[model samples]
Target: MGKLYGQPDRRPTAHPARPLVVDSQFSTTSVNNRVLVYQVPVNKKRPLLTISGIMSADFLPNVDPQQVMIGPAYAHPEAWVYLPLVNPSNLPRKMIVDLDHNRCDTLDAFLLRGQQRELVHLGTLFRRMPLVQRAIPVRAFALPFELAPHDSAGLLLRSRRSTGIHELTIALSTEKQFTIKRDEEESIRLVALSSAFFFMFTVFSLGLIFKHRLLIYFGLYVFPIGLGQLNYNYFFDAFPFPAWLGLNANSIGLFIIFATNCLFHTFGVAYIKSLNVYGRWHRYAVLFLVGANLIPMGLLLFPLTRTTNAMVTNASLILTTLNIGWLFYISMLGFRVKREKYLLITATLVFVPILYRTYVLDSPALSYSYFQPFYYLLLFGYLIVSLFRRELISQQMTEEKIRLVQGKLEMLRKSEIEQIGRNLHDQLGNTLASALGYLNLKEPRIQVARDMILDAINETRVISHNLVKDDNRPLDEKLEDLAERFNDFSTISFAYSDYTEKRINQLPLLKQQGIYLIVQEVLNNVVKHSQAKEVTIQAFLSEDVVRVSIEDDGIGYTPNQPTSGIGMANMYKRAELARLKLSIDGSVSGTSVTIETPLGG
Candidate 1:
């Protein structure tokens, strides 16, 4: 139990303990297990420190401890350094580990101290860190070390580095200041909370509204994007799903993100009310995005080789960059077509920081600081914009419907006025003229004048009754009247067939009105243009749908041939407002028009 200080003047005893097994879960091979112990002498004197820079990886397997003290230092790409310290006083000690690697790939620190059971456990000197936007962290760290029989035990630290020329600073001190904590990581919880809020907002918007296509697609897109942040930010580390979801979780998140990108591009190009604006080129771009999204599946099938890694990297780089470029292009299109400047600007402002955070400054650890405020705010903006657009489109549809309904009412008023004008000009005027003739002829025929007066009175009563009535006339009665009035010496006959009483009354009021107007226009077309001798109107109900059709036996024109008169346009517009599907078929033999509408509450 004799001890030597300042250096390892005593080789390890035969009963000395071996080093503990280093945990390497993902590694393919085993490591050499050799433990070295050194004893430092106690002194009320100044502290001691020893520092060395490693020049090559070869130095680790075979090392001359004496030669290591005298080796010349040269500036090189990667250095594995050995730093040892001896605390020789009967008090607590402190150490600082300062590393600077601008082009860093990986840094592993092993801090070893001796134990009675024949193994040494490494102290966690530094948490796992990944280079984010900043190439190098601008801070250093101070850590505490304690040992039993406090004065004479030493600590050993081995650092392996893989980077260009860099510096390492290890110091032994008696102070209590540690500067390893970063200000950015402190608010990690806040960022996570913000992400959660945005994520829930997207879900709420999706569940609340289905009136717009943008909302549906945008909601779907937000799902993978938000979860990807949580997953990459290490939020899932505490969750049980990651045990089974490991690796596959990341893979699936990436797949969904890619698919959402494709969907967003597609929906962005051709969304509600803007379907006519997206052309063949836009469709082709959407197809290209879909193909791009499928690239991640390749990782599942192949054992990754150098070529596969290169391919995957290229695909990811291309698609990720293209997502931004595609959005910019859409913004330009939106400005021209929809004047959606806020949509583009807010999106760009919101997403640019996200791009920097995601693509530039990704950390290996799920540190709270990994979640950025801009990413969450950007997502919130998207949700707001989607809902805003949905609301605008809904209002537009409602107003259009109101305008169409107003037109229908106006058309109904005009028809009634025209019929009243015809009755007064022909029937009532003729009867009054006959009464005047009975008096002017000097016949003094009181009974004949009385008869004419009664007829005139009845005509006035019918006109007044038709004008004041608000209830609907039966379809059959209206058709009979239309036939009698338009019968030019029996030149044309009206044939009408309708659904049963139960089904007919089940039709909505607006739907019935639309059908009646549409039929009236069809009969008028037959009279004015078809030279038709017979016109037939039919209606029926089938499978929760109500259908109305009109047919004529005369010369017929093609259906939807743009040159059709204003009456046809009115019928088409009315049918649209009523949510009815309309079609017309015309040929030399005859013409037929039909409309079908769903029954609704």
Candidate 2:
């Protein structure tokens, strides 16, 4: 070996003496061959660095070299390396270099070394980055280089990116192996992303449909988190982004982290705001936290320099600690409650892993967030389940309330019917008996018997009116009772639709009373004159109006025909008194009457 550029000729001290082919059992890919490694400083300025002392390792999925004990520059985003491109065989090799885009932002490689070196911007979102290269799914940047048989050249590589730590990787592989691995990984990622979004959408839609506040808050909190997951995982790098976003890997990551934190705090406050269990002071404290999170979130929008980066990093640690403490505190306050218990478990599961990644694993070679996807997935699933459980609980409580109310109403209804039956038997029955007794007299006391019969008729009418009278019960119930009474007296079938009963009941008592009376008069006419076999009644309430319709399939009467009965006249008088608009349509086959009134009327 001879030195180039007048530098010392030295072999990589850490390189393995023999090539070690890792077995498939311990590997993530089919081929896990060891590759030589080197490191260069961001500020070194020189094209290559002294690489004889760097650490090295075999290509294994679960193992990596220990962190290099180096100077401060080792943690900088601009990382450089020198790969000794060697072809020991007689045949030439077209080798592919793969970098996990999640680990870094931009990748650049130089062919040859010294004066003859040519620069290649392999992994980047800039205009210069090749469109075809952007299509690769797994690697952040895949750079290809060629070497003649039994020849070698120094390939210099740089990664201008960082994922909170100085870690970066340069994986070596044959072209065919790289393609197969990329496709397999791509399919898996698409499925995972699709499922995650689908779950998110489901929870969000439920929140809207049911109007569950906690689910709504949870949905809002998780949206940005999902986006941040994609951003940090390098999923977005597969597509081209507009330059106007002013984002590289690091800045975008910071922005997303800050935004997610802000939203989490905001939603956290909203979730607990109405819970009296947290107390007034705790609510105020949470509000303060939301305001506090906004400070860091706002600062991140400005141009980022080293000062901003350091500030943000320190802030993140402090804010994350506070967030965890808040979760624990809430769990303690509502420890007996199911929702708070879930929060406690979730916090406990996530807290330790984040601490381990942030503090214990301080290496540039290993991922700063190896367990990120797992923990975040855990959080997402747990939150959705918690919200659904809460909704189900609410529904159960509502149903219980309805059952209680219905039970009371049933008892009251039975009592009223019993009272009405006694009145009919005691009062009306006695009056009719007296009238019959008067007729039984030989001379018949004709006038006295007639007066007794009239008194009995009046008493029966009053009893019948009382049965369908409105009091504490709903207007629809009163109308339904009226229809049932009419059905008992005649052969006609009566149907009533109260689909908008809830809305109709919201109107003033006076309006409901007027509506009930008008409907009563119309039904009487259908029975007396229309000779209807079937009758249908429908009521609807809109934003500012109420409408009710009654139709009968019968031998209808002419509108202009003279009638001795006053039923039609009574309907018109009642509608006019209530300030309602009334319309009557009659044909040989049927008669329809509709009443419309403004809500205020």
Candidate 3:
């Protein structure tokens, strides 16, 4: 027989509402197959003892009466009943039975001999049953049984003592050996979805590291919402966790939703501000809300921390309201700023469904799954517009800088032309006039001297003409002119080939002049020092580049040998001005100077 204990009641004399009272009872029974079930019934509730029941061995219609024996009672009218049954004969036949709701609250089958009343708690249920006479404790709110001819006997459930109506129903059974477990399909799907979410989040994070704004925002704000939806569905539909964990499908969903929304708020502010739109007050509000949510998240990590469930719920509701309000505010601001109407409209449309699902509608049809993809799409559209705006602004700035530089270059070019004209008029003209005057004097002995003076005047005239003419022309034409003039002094042979005429025609004037001057210097060196039989000038033009090679089969000088000369230095300076790549190779066979320039066009 079970005993009962009473404790002093503490309560206010007058109460605003009626208090609920609970009464509970326990009994046990054993069937022929060595199965024991201790059934407890709490005051008449259909969902009995709140602890899941255990299976009996005989495949009885109800809790077996013969194997049951009464044990001790606890402090609050709680009772313990024991039922013991062995294996072997208990199996080979699957049994289905239903228990009376009013009598049996919960059933706990156990193998231990000692009874401890203090062990019974509201949230914990314990059961012990034997499999092939081997005892094991099963702890859960509910348990399913599959007993075979050769299998061991095990307890089906453990129940906490409580006053409620508990009814038992056999959920499933099969003659064929249990091949596949229940919830397996749903578990696999949930895992697959979780893995996908993890991958997408990782990708988003990497994109953020690289400063990809679209992917960053997508991962930060959008992907989490999808993950939240998946979590909500997964927890509710399959693989339900412990109630003590305080992580229900709804709680996880709300947490993810609020957190992701907070991120969106932050990113949105920055995104708008970058577009020269103001979002100051909204940003501050979002920051405050984010702080509030973070406190709850921190608290959740510790084991057995008293959950501020109401606070978390309230915070979630507030955040959702604030997010909706901010969305509307941003839409108004977008209108004032004349932002992209389609993007604004799309965002508004997307938000409407989420808002409706969250607040106005309770149906699963209005779930987050329907709206998440659309939200990401709207975000992508906004990102594209932002990128286009940035690119346009950058292009305008570049154009302005180019125009300023072009103006300065034009001024410099005009000044250079004016300076060159003055130098020619003041110096070369005076020298040529004096030479002409000397040539005009008549005398037989002085005639030879006069001829020499006339030749000098002619040479000076040609030089003056070249100095004044536009230096922009084909490099070959310039080099050919130099070779012709040099031929007047010494016999010159030129061999030029393997270059496209079309490319030569496209050389910029400045680059052409630089190459011409370099060739002229090389020819002058050949005349002054190299007693050569032939000279070879080759010019080649490739896409966006020009190469000129001038070679003479004459005495070559080693570059390492010391010399006091400005000719090579001047050639290098001309190359720098034209931005030409120059290389000179000299050997006993010949000396070759190669000048290369990249065509700007």
Candidate 4:
């Protein structure tokens, strides 16, 4: 008998139990027991393949067959299965048999319940053969056959031909593919944008700490938390770290976030408590939250024992929840206080969505990507508002100080005017009256007496006129007049220099009077107290300020020694009123009083 082989044209048939078959022709030959394998391609484009057992040798009647097999079997566009045959004898034998195929798609259909039933296709195939034929397209086919002993062959035949026949089976399933929807992608994009915005805002907010130091210390703590939250979400996926390291980073980051939140909360609580908005209980609550949140961070660093992962998560949740509740409470309190309403409203609006996203929605996309940035922005806004308010308060304080100084100066001016009036009436007026009475008394040198009396009267008149004059005259003119008047004494030599006419004229009348008084007092002290031989008054002006120096060549008196008069005290008081600075530098050689006043004054 020729080699028992079928042509390559064996069309594939769709049979649920046996979807593919290549039956061998009967051959009685003394050929060595050889097994032939067939390569069949299973179609994946159709349905999944369900494969089962091989036909037994006993299933063929009056045939001395070895064993039957199929494969280099390949299942397609999805998977592949291999079928093999074994021979007991060295001689090859082939048996005639009819290859049965059946469409058994409903094999497990009865077993499915409820929703599983929907997996079945709605339509039926017109031709079963086309399904299988389309499934396996390869041409080359072979089957393994083996010779068996008569007893074994007869047993296999009986088993195969029995009423209860067994068959190989396999189940196949198609996987459903899913794609991201537009809204999902949009959400992701929004999250990314929000995260980036907050990250930048956090950086700017942190910068404010340096720009506005003491006032923005709160921002220093707050910005770091914002950054931590941003980094935790945005960088986690992209960070090139090991799993444990990533988790550690995340834990540390979250620790910072909670820590900052606690810091801000505690600060807020303390600040509000200071305003008497909340009771001591509110402060205690803040302290408790702060302590709880800090425990993990402290443990993470050193000395303290490290917190367990579970404890950290639990503590963070508790702290966050309490903080959110407290924030709402404080906001309500703020509304009642009627002050800081804007801050309260802004913080509430900014943080509520974040809290909801965090605890309620549990959306990372919302928390890190969107809410964090918005939070930072709101924090920055708060800082700006705080700074502006602080500046306004500072300005008001400065104005109040200025007003107080002005009132004191006005009082001093009134007192000085009264004292000057008293001195002119008691000293100069009385001296002139005595000189007039002496002139009226007749004497042998009545002419000489009349001349002396006339001189004294003129002197008194000059003093009266000088006192009444604007005294707004240039410093040089004033100093010249003073020097000439002092020169009349003959014993005193007065000299002056380095005077700017325009600068002296530009000085405020009160400030000029201050300088003039300081000069006059120094001269009087030198002439009377120091018994000075010569006196020199010098004035100089620079772009920003003026300097007046009055030097008397006299025996210098030690500073702090109680003077025989109130000249020094009066000078100091006048300088204070005019806001001028005075320094008396003196020694045995001379006494120099240097007075500095702002030029425009």
Candidate 5:
């Protein structure tokens, strides 16, 4: 008993089982070969319609007469299979072998005909084995030949020695019901359509809640699904290339399948999170899934860890499928939660068909399967659900913010009252105290008291005026009055404009006050420090914006030098409160300050 005898109980799987051409031991014993002859069972006057099964064989002392076993026992990735289709008809007939699996890492097949076991050259059928070697686009592989009556041809499958489920399907149909793939052209067209479909999906995903990790993962899922399944069938048919190139094309497509599956599971976790789905073990489960999915990619992508055949990589798919299936199960867990329910439904709709396609069906008879469109539909559904969930969360957050702002506003009001109290005590208390000291009975002292008391009165008026200004007064009128006071007091003549009278009145009182203070601060600086001969203050309005500018022809102070006055800093605080922009630029000749305010506020 050898690799072929690794089968359980030696009961053949299904009636038309694939037989081992050679039987021998694999590990401990090798170099033994035995042949199993078969009489082609004529079906309804036609020869065998299909012959298919799994074959397990070893690499040591490789002897030919390739034997194929019938059972699930030898379904190991490292094990290889041998498929020989014998023709028992009196006349030549076309034989077709439709392989179910992407037969990998195999050499060209051979023809062993008659008792002499005459070896004949295999026709061009398996010549491009290298180029078309990949299991990517799970192709509809059919080995067709015109076998002379009583002729038998076989395929030698030396699958890559790796760990994972590895098997093949061999379908043979005699002349009567046999026909070339009817949808071959359409299938190729479908393969070509992948680019267009992928592009559209990418654009759509970008347009919708792109910031959301869910959309990002969905995009990740879609890209590989489209790129990997792009078998070289259409491209090569239209513009034939070298055999090696074809083989690479297949390999790349195959790589895409596993990679896409891994990424797809990540997208599932993102979906769960977006729906706010949670369980004690949910994150742990998802993290575990992510780790498992990445195993294959880590091994294959990292050059140092990769093997030539990468048969172990097949386990990646098994783990990936299990992870994906687990994700589906998790989605079901969310069924009771309303929001999560929709996400789950959409996920189910998306993944169920995928599971079906992977586990049950063959490569479609159509131009690619309709699975992509279904995937797109599901991806889009998830996108919409994600966006809706995000918006709902945003609304909740906004309400929370409003409550916080109300509390902050109340605190601001209390601070403002405290500020007014300090201003009154600091400014008025000192002047009143000084006036009280001058109050004496003597005539000279009485005169001093009269002067001091008058001074105190003036100080009281100034403090009151500053603390309480009628903000409703038009901004331009206030500026006009400012110009009058400055021009009368300062040595420098003042030039002013009032173009903002209409626009400035439309703004909020707080904003108008802020603008007014900025202008006042700028002018006061000019009077105290600048030795200017002339000054210009302008209030200009344009649409929604009002600009106040004050310029001095005085010796400008250096910006790098700090001033002891809080007047400028006070002006900045006011501008910040009102959301206005204040700028001050100075040179050797003078200083210019501009306060720009928006009327819409």
Candidate 6:
């Protein structure tokens, strides 16, 4: 017998119960005619290169191709199967050859003619076979072949470079059987794609409604993710575009996938850390991860080749490790800052499976099977629900704040009415009574009674003016004017001083008015009850707050005692309403009332 190429000079032996033969040689050819052609020694270390038993159309589907060991013998990055098939029929027949591997990049076949004991290639049966040879998304390449009686041919199945594990499976069937199988598989893929799209749409709609950028980022991320998955699963084989666009669909799809994926991570980290929840080191680490993720995308700019593909794969593996480590690190930091815990947990939980499916199990950072799209759908659902919950919580908090403000306003209104009533009765009623008593005296002192009646009228005017005072003036001017009015009312010497005049004037108009009212009430108490000979109004700044203090050299009362004075009570209530702090310190020499207001508020 003639010696075959890369085979021992002996007749190829067939199994007793099977018609399959072994040539003790294997070769993998690239589309550009680059070959990693080598021979596998017929020893225990060599894996089964060909299937045993009768190679019939019915039995081909059940034949499982052994895995190509990726050791020193087959160390090249690019690999595929070079299976030899024999025609076992006496009658000439036409058959459809199908290579069913989702991760396959290309598939082709060529006829083999026998010369002595060797098999030689005749001509190309097909080259760079289309992935979608059918009308649907079934990931199989089917080609029609005509075989003479007892003639043989070899099927060439080419797959992308295997970074870790690799396997191949082949099927031979009639044209009708291939159509039926393709249709059946197409239905399953369609359902998966539809479900993935539904989730994507739901997430995008929620993002539009809420206008949350986190959800929007996620929605955009899913688009390229779906494309990358389709590309990885050989869906792009049927619609191969020319490289005139600088990059084909495969490379472009992968580029977008990694780019968008990195953007998602960057944006997510930014959104969560927008409040400055994490520290500078965490941000620096994130920047490093971003740079690492970007390196792989830059590598895609090179032409798609075995070496370039391997480089991209190694870079992606590094990125995957960095991403996983970064997630765990961020999760650790998330525990320290409670606000980000939910976000960290959700992201880590959702992305763990996705990264595993994309990088660890399937292709790294590029392609995935049909099942991977649904993982994105799951992530989308999580983001939508989280945003809704946050919105609901924010709405509830706003409503609660409004209700509390209303209640405070009601209390302030009633307190003001009582204070006014007390002032009227205490000042006007007493003056009128004194005047009547003097006029009804036996001597009828008309001049003295007239003076008393005039005093009562003046008191009424003062009360009316205090009820509606002009508030457009600056706060320091208002304070000085108040002190002047109080000095006119009583013999208590009034002095106005402002050390932080600019700061006081910068306060909001509402706050200035509130401070003015509080000071008026405090001085009123000093005139009516304290019998103070001197009073000083002072304004100053204290640690992030503005303080207005009214000190009187009056008979001070006990601090804890419940006073019946409406002026003191109203002062406290007004301070509470204005969101200011009020404190009164009384000593044997004097009483000091201070109103402390936040500078920012």
TM match of model 6 to true structure:
0.55
Tell how far residue 351 is off in model 4, in angstroms: 3.9
**lDDT at 173 for candidate 4?**
12
Off-target runs (Cα >4 Å) in candidate 6 are: 1-78, 84-105, 111-140, 146-154, 158-177, 229-245, 274-276, 295-311, 328-368, 379-601
lDDT of each: 0.50, 0.59, 0.48, 0.47, 0.51, 0.58
- Candidate 2, TM-score vs. the true structure? 0.54
lDDT of 4 by residue, 1-601 (tens): 1111111233233221211122233222211112111222333232222222223221111111222222111111111122222233444444221111111111111111122221222122111123243222211011122233321221011001100011112211111100122234336545645654554455446547435332344445455555554443333323454543323322345455566666677447544653455677876777788888887665444221122433454455556667767766776675676455655666666777766754454321112333345445556566545644665577679679779867876776676567556655765567666666666776545566566566555545444433545455766577667767666643668887765655665676678777776776676566546778888888887777788888877888678777544457778988987789999877888777899988755
Quick one: best lDDT, which candidate?
2
Cα shift from native, residue 367, model 2 (Å)? 6.3
lDDT of 2: 0.59
Error of 3 at 136 (Å): 21
What TM-score would each prediction reach against the true structure? 0.45, 0.54, 0.34, 0.33, 0.43, 0.55
| lDDT tens per residue, model 3, 280-322 | 7755776786776676555443321212543453455556567
**Model 1: colliding residue pairs:** 132-361, 133-361, 188-368
Q: What does candidate 2's lDDT look like per residue over 475-505, in tens digits?
A: 7887787888777766789988876756777
**How far in Å is the alpha carbon of 154 misplaced in model 5?**
7.0
lDDT of 5 by residue, 385-479 (tens): 56556655886796796687556545554655565466457656765676677664343367666776665565454444445454467778887
lDDT of 1 by residue, 106-200 (tens): 33444434432222433332323322322233322223444333433333444332211122333333222333233433356446656655654
Residue 156 deviation, candidate 6, in Å? 3.4
**Highest TM-score: which candidate?**
6
Of candidate 5, the 10-residue stretch with the lowest lDDT total is 23-32
